[model samples]
Target: ASITERFEPAISWDQVARLREIWKGAMVTKGPLGAQDVVRAVELGCDGVYLSNHGGRQLDQVAHPLDLLVAARRAVGRKTTILLDSGIRCGADVAIALACGADYCLVGRPYLYGLAAAGQAGVEFVIGMIAEELGRTLQLLGLAGVADLKAAGEGVVRYGGSPASRPGDTGDFGVLQ
Candidate 1:
């Protein structure tokens, strides 16, 4: 409740402009699920926008990070960077985020799982596993590289409708979409 109250006002453009003078390193604003907030961030000269619902730990009924990627991409266009951090468990999820317009996706629980299981070695193992899986996923999707995944677009990542009945839809194309 306290955190919710504190965030009620949201950050102002003036505040970001002021912070830009002091913070020399990269500045990324997170926790927004709307295009307007993203536009504001870009206007303020933010380095990037990290799209997140705090893993759904902050609020309920928040749109999935992948879903937000579409609107964010349209709002920011291709030049501005976009990152996602929510419900991404494996390489497949990473692929979906990228196709949906996310430049990069952040995984949180996976790292924590690695840490809880076996410290640094576990983290290394997890990273290796994800990398291998991502490579395989790309290959299976007939993609040559991460850049190729973007070509898949929303056609590869479906949310909750019947695949065949999706009007003009042909088939699953082997991905979630």
Candidate 2:
């Protein structure tokens, strides 16, 4: 059977609250995409909210995780730490996620790719490349750290398509609030 089918696929609120009562360390819930679910996780005592689409492996046509970050942040406010994963292959991707409101990004495939390509050296190379790109992105955006990304907001990243791809002659499109 598949991994999803092998285990109990459903979770209950009582189970989450009970587990939180028994655990000493931080508790987090992963793969929740809705703002209401994020808010509910906080109510259930989750220390963090992990936004993911299972790397787009679990379902088709799900919203991009980055696109959901802002709503999740608004739903939970600043009290809960919101994290994101999936489709993050580089440092710039990391920066974009943060600017969109993710407190942290969890990378999986990039590390796995590095490991499969050349072991330790490849892993180190990938890490260094991401760090370098992060630094350059910060400098170019005139920001000092990742925390400053919150202020950069939606203008820092562009979704949809290239500017030239738009057929209109007007330059009056405003940022979505």
Candidate 3:
């Protein structure tokens, strides 16, 4: 059987193989390029990577890391500590990141305002807000517990990126085609 036929809840090399096949043809580099950059990064001894075009805010228009995250993860294999932190703003986003294969995430702007707004107190407030919002967000999705979040995607996807040919496909933003 093929990789798809071997997918398991525990996830295996077969599952990873399937992902690579689907996304290998999808990786892209800056403004449309080749796949060598990704290969080069790994060969250079980088243990992990984060795919981003500076959160799309810097580029004005670019592919979402969500698409690149999957492709990148598959490119490097499961051992890589792949982390992504662009355009993530909600608890649902957290789920999406993990689903797309982010080992860790980074949220940038939220803390800046808290530091500027009320110093330490403001920062605490922002933390609380994020926690409350994340919990509520997960609760609404029937994921009352964080562990339950493992089964994300529910097969529901919101895709984008011109390089990505599928409906929401945005392939890879900056990666060389």
TM-score top scorer: 2
Candidate 1 regions exceeding 4 Å error are 1-9, 21-25, 161-177
Q: What CA RMSD would you report for each candidate?
A: 3.8, 4.8, 14.5
Q: Compose the digit string of candidate 2's lDDT tens values, residues 47-143.
A: 9988898888875478767767877887887799988998888877877777777888888888888989999988888888888887787887888
Q: TM-scores, in order shown?
A: 0.81, 0.83, 0.60
Rate residue 169 of model 3 by lDDT. Answer: 41
Summed over model 2, clashes come to: 0
TM-score, structure 3 vs. true: 0.60
lDDT of each: 0.77, 0.76, 0.56
On the 0 to 100 scale, the lDDT of residue 140 in model 1 is 80
Clashes of each: 3, 0, 16
Q: How many backbone clashes does candidate 3 have?
A: 16
lDDT of 3 by residue, 105-133 (tens): 77777766888999989878877777787
lDDT of 1: 0.77
Candidate 2: regions farther than 4 A off: 1-5, 161-177
Which 10-residue window of candidate 3 scores lowest in summed lDDT? 26-35
**lDDT at 82, model 3:** 60
Stronger candidate by lDDT (1 vs 3): 1
